[model samples]
Target: MDQRVSSLAPPTIYVVDDDDGVRRALAFALDLDGFEVETFESGEALLLRDGLDAAGCLVLDERLPGISGLDTLRQLRARQVALPAIFVTSHPKPLMRDAAARAGAPIVEKPLEAETLIAAIHDLLRGPTR
Candidate 1:
């Protein structure tokens, strides 16, 4: 973990989902786990934000209205953002998983299990290789 414990800040988790219910549920779950969280309705909203590096991880839905999750992840990588991210979607095809792996992002399918989601969150906190 490349985290600085003395920074006086909790690790922030950014959750980006176009669906209102999903965004709310995920945010609630993360918050309940004592993580600082920020929720966004779309990739474009997140793209317009500043200081993304402050976040410890990003939990993003693979499909979005504009600038899809994969594309957003590509942009983030292009910008050299090192934040760990996990991609979630209803359609977790082999090709998508391969691409995500290539981009250093991991995939988590929808109907997300509590255990799996928490484990992924831990893995994100653990760092990229985990």
Candidate 2:
């Protein structure tokens, strides 16, 4: 086994999106980019799993059915789960952006370019300053 690979646990990406196509497409893309992925249809599904303790980042759609992505992040924070998160949405209003910022999540607009999302994920994994 490669020493580097053995030294670090594989990074898993938790993706929460209401759109079936979008969730599947993102999982496919991220998998191809060499990241492990877990998909949820809604923020509620993710919260129910109680599996956020894993070493990974979160890619969430802002306007989820049950709990909004920002609210989900807030809940996670309240629980002391500090995973890096990125929010994607078609509507990028100032209020949403501010909320996401407060949660320490970057908001990416929908109709996302695959490369950009991938790059952002990589950057987040690298750490906040990177």
Candidate 3:
């Protein structure tokens, strides 16, 4: 993942996806949109990162190597991280869909439309009440 260091810090969007292509593509796109993105290949990696409580948001794949996205989010929430999250999935199962709803994260289906993800990020950045 690419992070453009600037004198002015942009909003931080932590992205966790196993697919290197997807992770790098997202970092490139979000970077253009003026976000400081840090990427991870697994929930374990993300979990190990510092400063998630101060993060702006998260974009997580529904499936991962070690922990599922839901479990990752749950652990974060359990720690009271409270960062808003979006799930990107190629094929979403009904059970997972239901769980995502319970988690209060929107699912953006892949072959991802950048606009959709960007809009969601903006909305999340607005506030929890949005």
Best model per lDDT = 3
Q: What lDDT score is found at residue 94 in candidate 2?
A: 89
Supply the global lDDT for candidate 3. Answer: 0.88
Best by TM-score: 2
List runs of model 1 lying over 4 Å from the truth.
1-7, 128-130
Candidate 3 positional error at 85, Å? 0.4
* Candidate 1: clashing pairs of residues: none
Candidate 1 residue 78 C-alpha distance from true site, Å: 1.4
What's the best-to-worst order under lDDT?
A: 3, 2, 1
lDDT of 2 by residue, 9-99 (tens): 5689999999999989999999999888999998888888776745799998988888898888787888888899999999799898788
Q: What lDDT does candidate 2 reach at residue 128? A: 56
Local distance difference test values of all predictions, in order: 0.83, 0.86, 0.88
Worst 10 residues of 1 by lDDT: 1-10
For model 2, the local distance difference test gives: 0.86
Report clashes for each candidate as comma-separated counts.
Answer: 0, 0, 0
RMSD, each candidate, Å? 3.3, 1.8, 5.0
Report residue 34 deviation for candidate 1 (angstroms): 0.9
lDDT score, candidate 3, position 41? 97
Q: What is the TM-score of each candidate against the true structure?
A: 0.87, 0.91, 0.87
Model 3 segments beyond 4 Å from truth? Answer: 1-8, 53-55, 128-130
